[model samples]
Target: MADGILYGKPISYFPNGYPLFIALLKLIFSDALVPTILIIFNIIFQILSQYLFFKLLIKLNLNKELALITLFFVAIYPNQINYTRQILTEPISLFLLILSLLMYVSNKPFLSGITGFLAAQFRPTLIFLFPLILIHEIISKNTKKSFLLGLGVILCLFFFKILEYFNLILPPDNLKFNLIVATYSDSFNINWELARSKLSIIKNPLSVYINHLITNPLDFLEKRIISLWSLWGPFSVTHRGILEKILIGIRFPLFMFSIALFLLRKNLLSKNILIITYLPILVITFIHTMFFSQQRFTFVVEPFIIMHTVLYLYSFKGNFLNEN
Candidate 1:
């Protein structure tokens, strides 16, 4: 809640990796420069992401008109743009995830391994893609190669974790409780701690699976819309009028539409993005249980998931295309 807590001290909003990223940047530049550079970099990356997405469409054999319209929609996705500017881990992680995916689509397994390694640093959950990548290896009959690549990724991650320790970037946080404390400083929370304790409902398959289906719609909506303004809650308490409530409640319509299109896409059932997008979600929900609940936390994987929707929309030959 305090600027002093976030900027002056260690800000622990997420895992140690993102904080490590911030620390790495600060080692080379001043704080004032970090935000400015991040803002500029994000804008550039946003444009590049648009271009690459269009290129991806072209690769998938979409028409030029269709590809450009797709690009426009992605470019104007306000929630995504806000995410890009936040100096957070999601943007770069998602970018690299898309890169690895593109490389995979282009017949480059090695590059996928490399990009996935980089993306893992931005979010540990990225490792969940290993199963799918392993399947790719098996499909290619390169079992040994897949195993070794995965091993290499694990070793590299360990190397970074070790380096972080040597540099004292990831000390006490290696202990989950301390990490949570470091991630977002608050005095303490009886409610969160209680909810986190009861997260074991996930260990039971029937309950977890059933609850996931029943709660997913509301959970997804609340996590997206309500999560945003909660960050600055004390700062903006009285400002939650109807429109603000809607915005805060639902993320952005484009993002929701993107998600909708993805879920409806029949092709996704057989797509590689399933591992990168859908399965990780199940695992994450189980693991986090009741501990944390924010759309942004899950949003790290949104773009890759979004591609499925975008691709599906393309198949429809629909007229949702925006005029530029």
Candidate 2:
């Protein structure tokens, strides 16, 4: 930030929105105060995320009590709370995504697109959702208006890439880097040392990545499945006590059951609007699984997951316990 502000250099390695957010804070407060302020800001977003999540549940036809139960889960979810302490984009981006969904569900496509675009700036993986939205719009024959809304998102993302192309900001190479790591990292039987050495010397890592996929198709597919499993798998925190483990274990089966019910019973994409709204989850899941596997990267979709899960559990009434 100092280098960018002082030397007028474009910072590109990460998305410009988040670093600029930090820079603005640094301008107002000292370096020591910045982390504190950022964390506070993240906490505020976390609260807002839960609030909007409650609204989303209501929009989904869930009763207020059921919505409140979902909100409780959002508030207490360890992973959701854990990320807020760190000065990362997930908290804010997650909040923005929920807000975007709210707007979309409320029939404000332009505003939803704008908010979603901002969220994408914070986390570029979100750009994948826009294309899915576009596909939905076309399939539903929403015509130029819907197409334009989707185009707005594409334009916002393209603006950033254009800036990168001109060296106006940092290069957005994280996706490429992650792809290289996913292909050649130790998970695929290539040790980090060797992978790092190869990547370090490669002039065109993407080409090599493509070649690896061509020659080792099974490895690529296997790694993506492993990534998906990790994303939705049991919640395990390192160095936690037995009680924590037990709680997570208890939640795991219920969570899985909820997901199963959602996939089998819920017509999430049945409506045209819903198709455009929630298609991002499927698109993002595939992209994240293919290129990266961090739980944090998939955090934006958790509120919906929790909401559906809670709704399913609540529907069972006492039967959920009786059967168990």
Candidate 3:
């Protein structure tokens, strides 16, 4: 798709934000060099993400040692390193997401909103949490900042509309497909014909979901539960190589353990950090439960998970004993 775009072909599928970015790179350099360039950029983004994450921790007043430890883990994280070799949106989206949070915590709302908008373009899953952030700003009486943030998002939307009008890119048209797919467990083999039949009538994904919930509540609940588990499930043993399997096996347990500790010690953490880190994880998890869930979808929030977990461990030193 990116090659097609580079060759001046119209993108008939979903909006090609990430692909467009890749195509633009290909335009600047030879096609053969594009892959290498992308990999390097991914690595750079990963490093910058770590740096921004450390800054975020400091801004939240977390202990320097704990923040450094979290930074080390994020830098050496297997999935983060592995993703740098692929031409996927994860690395860039993760960087932008972390940067957006950092900007927000630093009270740079306009910059935060702009970065957040870009992150959503690369990974639309971020869209689910934007409203929650806006609401938080309003509730905290940061009216001026909220307005600036809203304006930033609105301006981005307007630019997108202009590009869409020019037929440069198409808006996402996968909600029905995602909604249909969400009805089944990741392990289920889907019948495309039956899926298409359902999709043909699904004008509203929420309506379809509600109907499914009303008609077959148990099946709906079961499938959603399975989807939730799949989001955090370890990499497949049969499909992945031994090293990948071993790395994920170790990482999976640690991720879960951290999450457990975060939940238990959340009260000792900063509310701003909680809103920026913990809430997005929950929002994404909930969104995936209603749509299609995948382990890769969790990548965007993995850093936050690490940050929350490390902050939780840091709390045991009684540093936050006076915190409400």
C-alpha RMSD by candidate, in order: 8.4, 4.7, 3.1
Tens digit of lDDT per residue, candidate 1, span 1-324?
113223445433345555565666676788788888777766776666666666555555556775676566556554576678787776777677667656656656566677777776676666667556677678879766676666656666676677555544432222244223222222222245643454433244345434554677565334333334332122223344666455444434434554565567545334544544455445444333333334455554444334545555665665433333
Query: How do the residues 179-293 of candidate 3 rate in per-residue lDDT, one tens digit apiece?
Result: 7777643433435676678776767866777788899999888787766666666554337688877776554665675687666876666678668877778888888876656
Candidate 2 lDDT, tens digit per residue, 1-324? 434833558654566778767777777899888889999999899989888877766665556776788789778876777788898899999988888878767767777788888888787888777666766667789786586677667677687678667655675556656667777762323255665676567878778778888999897778777666546656544456887656545445645755565575564323532453346567667777777566566577766666657656665563211111
Model 2 has a clash total of 2
Candidate number of the best lDDT: 3
Off by over 4 Å in 2: 1-6, 154-168, 186-197, 235-255, 267-278, 317-324
Give the poorly placed runs of model 3, Cα more than 4 Å off.
Answer: 1-9, 184-207, 234-238, 241-243, 250-262, 320-324
Looking at model 1, the pairs that clash are 12-182, 12-183, 12-184, 13-183, 225-248, 225-249, 225-250, 262-309
Worst 10 residues of 1 by lDDT: 181-190
TM-score of 2: 0.82
Total backbone clashes of model 3? 0
- Can you give the TM-score per candidate against the true fold? 0.62, 0.82, 0.87
Residue 58's lDDT in candidate 2: 65
Candidate order, TM-score descending: 3, 2, 1
Q: After superposition, how far is residue 265 of candidate 2 from its true place, in Å?
A: 1.8
Local distance difference test values of all predictions, in order: 0.53, 0.68, 0.76
Top candidate when judged by TM-score against the true structure = 3
Clashing pairs in 3: none
